[model samples]
Target chain A: MSAAPELNPAIEVAGLRKRYGVGDTAVDALKGVDLTVQPGEVIGLIGPSGSGKSTLLKCLGAVTEPSDGRIRLSGETVYDGGWHDLDPRALRRDRIGFVFQAPYLIPFLDVTDNVALPLLLAGRSNREARQRARELLAALDVQHRAQAAIAQLSGGEQQRVAIARALANQPPIILADEPTAPLDSERALAVVRILNRMAQQYRTAIIVVTHDEKIIPTFRRLYHIRDGRTYEEAGAGRDLG
Target chain B: MISLAGRDILHSWGKYAFTGLGLGLLIGVTLSMAGIYRGMVDDGKALLANSGADLWVVQRDTLGPYAEPSSLRDDVYRGLLGLPGVAHAANVTYLTMQARQGKREARVMVVGIQPGEPGEPRYLIAGRQIERTHYEAVADASAGFQLGQRVRIRRHDYTVVGLTRRMVSASGDPMVFIPLRDAQEAQFLKDNDAIVNERARVRANPALNRPGAPGLAETVSRSQESSRMVNAVLVQVAPGWSAAEVAETIRRWKRLQTYTVPQMEEILIAKLIATSARQIAVFLLILAVVSAAIVSFIIYTMTLGKLREIAVLKLIGARNRTIAGMILQEALGLGLIGFLVGKTVATLWAPYFPKYVLLEPGDAARGFAAVMLICALASTLAIRTALRVDPATAMGG
Candidate 1:
């Protein structure tokens, strides 16, 4: 494949550090980390337990403020030193998407409502939110079960719905933690393929955090974190088709 | 926008409905307590209405005639009738006693009324009113005395000739109407042994049984047999004259207590049943507190169960106010169901009470509003807990 033209980085971080407690009792979790990701790219994040994988994910997701860092997403500076330039909740709602280990769909809401919640929160009308959710569900190939209750769907169907929800607002970046850890090898590769197809179709960047070994070879680029720092690595790029 | 509260409730409707049913039973007890108090007041008013008298001329400086012991000479009506604006006056006496029919007995308020006067039973539901000068009685159906049944009062046996409805004393005691002479004797008569002993004591007194005074024993015996006192004089004011004016004249000139229709109503409602109203008010306060506590406990538990979901929603950009509103709406929905169930239950069981249970539409409306307000206030605790949840917990490391 030709070397793809790199667009302006969707996420750029520098000197990101986080510490818990104070004084002599303080323990550093993330020690001066730096990272970058371009739009329309799917990158894997892997680390041993307690290797600061979650801390880095929280800082990236805008859920936890870093003690000392500079974070710029889509050309907008979000965090610097001890302050955040944007509302964290609004940022999470409008620009960032999160998928979790289990498909944590709200049990009370139907599949469509679960997917449309972010769009609705972002001030879209019901019809508009529903239309967007339907398109995303159709893209994820789960449109037939959009109106079903979250509990009625199978595990795979539920995961697909969660993925649809993540792309509901067409956020430029998606952060998924342990997205395929529970699935077997075939299902795990299927999830990675779907993520790749979505990133290419929507031109969105995605960071997948996982420790599962079966699907690690599918990525072209990967980041391995050890001792609170990330190092870039080349993937196996094995063909599944 | 989708209503998170509505969707949650619909998802667990069975659980919510069962909880509401439990709360509704509590509310039903509260409403029934209120109705009981109203029944007592209504019974007092009914007693006055059934009396059919415009003025009650009682003994001097006393609130009696019904609430306390009262006595005036039976002949006082003759003097009261002579006054201007007094169209008719009748001597009436009230005595609460146990009347026996064969093997069964019931507590009844015996009203001594003169024939063809204002003190008689206003209307009958079954038989005719007392047409005889003696031995005929009219009993309220609640007293369980059937027509033609012989009921013994004191030493006399009277046949039940009439039955009335809605005639009760302030204390919910049914009433029985008898002739003035019989009622007076039944109320004040001594036993046979006591009468003999009284006669012997009179003879033993030298001033009363002088040897030269013939027929002295007989005269003394006649005095012992007669009942000269009555409870009150029931008076009717002439047309074009005010009852208050007549009552005032009697109070000033006759040196006796007089109560007009409105004044008598005050005595029955405010003075006679004041303590009962306070009792009911205290019960209402306790029930309200209990309802609030129960609602709070239920809502708090429900919110605790959904803590995980709330954290997830918060992490995904749900506002604190949105989550709080959802919890409050669920509590309010439960309260609405409870109030409807409570009101319906109270109304259905009202007629079964031994006493009248007056369920006013206005009281029910106020009760419903209060229930909703209380529920809204009670849900604040759960809402606060939910809003304080940290979105970081959803990560669940």
Candidate 2:
């Protein structure tokens, strides 16, 4: 029900600029970045350190405002001349999902509750939210561990649960900042494989920010960022094992 | 919404419980301090109530019987008995001294009470009241005296024939009631050597040793050796008469210091125990400050420890109110646990204290409210810290 329109681009950004501080001391973190992603696509944003990948992700996630940009998410203008007529907190809650290097699942909550938290926060009934979470766990192949505490899960299973959490609210865009950074090669590839399958199945666009070499070739498209700008590249789209 | 605070507490219950236990001991000390003050006030009231008097008559210009020294002729009660509206009046003496039983001694208020009169203790728990004129005594149960125990006061050893409960002085020393003649002797008795020296001084006087006054010196010596003074006269008014009227008549006509029951209660509680009450008050304030500081430090440390998680929750769209609420709820939870443990601990240890510890329900309710309020205020620092955590912190550089 929260999916984007069938034909429109899932995310749109043009001349997006972000600056830290103000007046003479202000330093630009993101400048003139343009990107677009249609529904049901998973792309990579790869660069060396200090390339404004995080800054751009912060802008896209609505956590930080862009100084100069025309941004749209799920066919709605989120940041234009200024902020759009929508609450940023609600936008992040209902429209955007984030996956960091660590799974970052709340340790106090069990896996099912962790995945179900987003829905609960959006005012869904407990039974309905948990039911949806179990469905997602089954799809991610962690259904057996749904009732377990987060500490009891393996690294791969925790990441899977984290992805399920991100998908709970059915956000059209999931900005993954190095979701596989702490994993071995096999686990990293498996995470990418899971992301691609989720994107196709749910018609969600995912932007994975990574410096990992093992999963880089799996993206059909890659946005190589340097000096706060992006240069798109085609990937091998190799068959996942 | 899910109760984030509840989940967190359940996850780390041991940490919460142990911390609460430590805080509970502090709260227990605080409550016990308050109980001590109440006990002092209660002791003063008990001293007044156990005397079975409607009015107190002492020497003029003195705080009679409990707070200050006073003395009057032992025969003053006869004049008081003849006064209009006076039902009964009897002489009573109060002397705080150490009573010895062989090797054991305890501080006691030795009260010289007239038998079958207004000064007798109201009820007895063991044995009979004083029947002898010289040496029978009734002891408070708290004095650790048994029936038929020989209690030595000054040079004379008396038999404890009766026991009473809750009969204490304004200063919390247990009461030991004896007959009036024995108490007067104890108050005015001198050593035989001093008596002999006094007798020699009296007989050596030329006017007294003259033939016409041959026996006068001996009579004077005997009179000097005997004492007929009492500290206060306890008066009971007739059923149809007002004690205040009788007290006023005594004060104006007889020229004596007289106080009605309520006025005497005020003197004993307000004047006698004022300093101890203030001391306990100072202790209570210090304990409150210490409890607040400990709670604040604990909550602040807990908030700091979970900064990362807070940042993640913020980035995931948890509101500022939600995060702050979690911290506040946790602080209150700690206070509730602490109060429960403290109340139980205070009750369990109250009897072991040397002084009577009176834990009133009203004071306990007020203490519970104060603790909850302190906890709520203590959580503010942690709440502020949590709110300042930037949502962007969850997105690492």
Candidate 3:
């Protein structure tokens, strides 16, 4: 019940590093990345292909074991030196969310099932999971299509369902990879506005990785990753209208 | 937890149904093979039951008169009837040959029995049992013969006087009953040219012609012209007499081979048709292996198609057991559909086979259990694939 501005910072990363393979063939994907974001802030991550943006996101999400780093989320130290204190799967499930460039909704499931899956996986009863999913879907203005198949929804509607799914578990941080890259300029800008509103309303910090020129200026803060390194910068933060 | 497998099946029911139907046809063939074996066993039992004889007295050390050839004297039944436990006995002959009705020849077991005796057809569906001693015959309904129809057996033509059903030999040959005298003549009667040759040879033998007696050669020729051999004696034991006792008594005192009803059945099923049973069993085994292989390949391919989805699920806190359960449930569903279709197809086509197809309820029930077990085992390959999928794959590359 805390307001977005009054909440503490949700993520802090320092000197994070990641490498693939081993010995002679190892390739360092993330060299030494450092960053932080307050709760309710919508930040942008921009970089060319193979510039280590994905590696940084993966380290932040705890999906890969970082070679060296310290990561803190919601005032808790989740990793340091050697993945200090949390089960990676539990950490990802209970503390983080994800949104992809494509909706990636399971084709077999309906909109409600796709949205409620994470909550169900977290051990919630079906009724409880469905109840939480419906609230988020309604907030995102896609509740009318709750029973529709994932394939039946339009591109924009499917993306809205994906955003609703990321919010269903009420995680402290969300990592979005090219959330609106496939949309038209107007639709892309509309998606950024929705992300900002969702962050402020839910008090969740969100990092969106994008190369879309149309929506890059919508964030107040941004990070530019190049050659396995990161640099912070300011965005336009101006209203789309 | 949400049911991943149930959702997938419901989403693509048409594809699953069509695949299940194809699998069902294969399953149907397996069931039919099993039915054919059962039918053979049933026919063996029915043949023993319909004979209405307490003991079969044949030539010493022979498996006749169904499984092998044995030629006992036609008058042996007379000596058997005077035994302590004997009530009635009759001469019976069996010959497997083609009988011509109109222009078509049907393979039949030509059974020659005494009229008004225990070895004749028990009851008739049409016409009467053979009334005339020499030229009348009683045919099984399956032989496609009608009353008063003339059927040719070898060189002789006989009128069909009666029709009966379910009277078949162990080899599935329909039975045609004729008088014992006629059958004996047809089974061993030689050609006229051979008889003529034999007569010339005999007339020319000095030991037989002996100039002292001119009629000796003619007398030997007349004896050769007549046939007198019979297959076996079908005997009915007296009231309160045991078939085993009678058979043992005949074997010991009469110095003849005798078999009780059960022993005859064993010979027919275990010895006569054992090779065929083994062949069918091998076929059933092959079909089972083929079914299992198809299930494994299908499940493995399906799991491969959902690699990304599995990774996402794993990242979102799905347990390994839940994933495995999903794959197993899908396999069970596939098996359920296949079994229903297979059972239906087997039942629908059973009667059309040339032989009886006995699809017992017990066999069907066993088949269902086997299919479920096979499906469960087959899903292990898919489960292993799903479990090996790394959750890190879901992160952007």
Candidate 4:
């Protein structure tokens, strides 16, 4: 097999716009937002409530369509001049990963299968997907609980499995929406630490949307969105020791 | 891909099993309803088969001996015997009434058949055929009659000398067969006081009591007390002739209604029991509707409870068909459970029914197919709702 090709600028968005409803009742959620992130970079997106942070994440994750935007993942155009220039669902499955505010792991599945789900959905064989899930779980320090049911796991362990699921297909980009909303200060910083380490090891770009104060200073770079617009700045880059 | 549906079911097997059991009982009732209708039709066919007649010759324009009332001269069988293709003919009478043994009584169809005649019981399960003609009767085992039991019909009591199996009327009434003369008398006989009053009234008529006709009124009064009329004449055609052809000849020569075996079957099953068949059909339709509704409601409710799980599946890039396949498989699984339980329970309870409940294998196969179809259709509502679930909702859950 040929070696996998590498792409720069893991995620790129320009003048993204999203509006809900039509006619006199329409409300603009995202207006002309522009952003970029490179491979192996972990960026923070922080803003007050109703500042278009969720709208931006939905647009990037392909969960919702943008009214007008230019989006590229791994240097390939996804949406430009129309809603779907590329197959949106296939693009999402192959190139993008998502982490929600809650772990939302399937209660019916065990911890290993929950993490292996994306690989399975991507059409990988069961043994291969499970092997990959085990490797990621070990790296995240939750491999001992691989055989446990989702409901049997602690909150931190469940969140760890969720992260493993996001990275299952080795996607070029991951969009985390309020992933630390339910965690305490220690657990929240631990989640950020894992994200940073996984980004470096896998060369995967990640964007975390958070309102938690405990882990805000951990990002070296932050993007503040206000009134559907973005302002980039630096973070405290605090040490965990 | 891993089977999401299988995993989910395994996780909650107890719940699924209990739900399936409840649905199974409803399905069992539906299958029994279908069996009851089949039994009614089988009863009609069996009633015709036991008569041992190839042709039924009755009064003109009447379907008789089983369905409608008809009366013919007792000597009509002699003339029918003379017709070509007519091997043998015998007069027969039918009267549906109560037969009492002490205080216990049973409603039965009293059939009048001569010895070695076409309308006689085909087989005896117990005891011997009637030897003494006057007060001997053969009763169906279904009527709970045993050998040597004396059953009273009208004023005279008759001994049950023989027992037959499956000897029943088209309406499922067990039969009590007696000699032709006795059945004729039992059908038309009156109380002694009423008979004496009838003779006196006839003598009082001046035209009949004329001086030149001194004995005419007496003869007329005696005639009024007796009858030589029968319900029908059962004819057996020779093996060389077609029953239809013989029936046509009889109808043309005798100027009476003639029904071949197939025609008699049509009269007994289609015309005689049409109302009962329609009632069973309505019941089957209502049961089918109720079963479908229950399945739909169950699946839809289950889907509604798992909205968050469905959203997460979709948001994680699981294809829409994957989610739909899970719901479809679950519905079909429920149906399979129901069908197995239904078939088992229907078989278990069939023999205890008051009427015969014929659970044919073919009908069970059809019932299986119907249950699967209904479950598949019932899953559509849940599938639609799951597909419409927005994947973004997981962000909140």
Top-scoring candidate (DockQ): 2
Give the TM-scores of the predictions, in the order they appear. Answer: 0.94, 0.96, 0.93, 0.93
Across B311-365, the per-residue lDDT of candidate 2 in tens digits comes to: 8888888888989999999999999999999999999999999889999989999
What are the Cα lDDT values of the candidates?
0.87, 0.90, 0.88, 0.88
Candidate 2 clashes between residue pairs 3 or more apart in a chain or in different chains: none
Could you give candidate 1's per-residue lDDT for residues B1-397 as a string of tens digits?
Answer: 7999899989999988888888888888888888888888888778888888999999887887877788999988998998999999999989999999999999999999987898888989999999898999999999999999999998889999999988888888899999999988988877789888988988888888898997798699779867899999999999999999999889888889999877888888898888988988998999999999999999999999999888878878887778988999999998988988888888888878888888878788888888999899899999999988877766654
Question: Native contacts recovered, in order, as a fraction for each?
Answer: 0.47, 0.54, 0.61, 0.68
Top TM-score hit: 2
Write one digit per residue (lDDT tens) for candidate 4, span B197-295.
988888898888888877998898788878799999999999799999999998888899999999998998899888988988898889888889988
DockQ of each: 0.66, 0.69, 0.64, 0.58
List ranges where model 3 is wrong by over 4 Å. A1-8, A81-87, B123-128
Candidate 1, residue B273: how far the Cα is off, in Å: 1.9
Q: Cα lDDT for residue A72, model 3?
A: 84
Question: How does chain A of candidate 3 score by TM-score against the true chain A?
Answer: 0.94
Clashes by residue pair, model 1: none
Tens digits of per-residue lDDT, candidate 3, A1-241, equal 1234544479988888888899999999988899888898889999999999888887888878889988888877888887676788888888788888887778889999999998987899999999999999999899999999988898888988988888879998999999998899877887887788788888889999999988888878889999889899866567654
Q: Model 3, range B223-307, lDDT digits (tens) per residue? A: 8888778888998999999999989989988899999998998999999999999999999999999999998888888888888
Descending-DockQ candidate ranking: 2, 1, 3, 4
Q: Listing every candidate in turn, what is its Cα RMSD in Å to the true structure after a full C-alpha superposition?
A: 2.3, 2.2, 2.6, 3.3
Note the chain A TM-score of all models in turn.
0.96, 0.95, 0.94, 0.94
Interface RMSD, every prediction, one decimal place: 1.0, 1.1, 1.4, 1.6
Residue pairs in clash, model 3: none
What lDDT tens digits, residue by residue, belong to model 2 across residues A1-241? 1124466799999999988999999888887899988888899999988899999999999899889978988678889978788778888889989898998889889999999998988889999999999999999999999889989999989999989999999999999999999999989998998998899898889999999999988888889998888889967667774
Model 3 chain B — which ten-residue stretch has the worst lDDT? B388-397
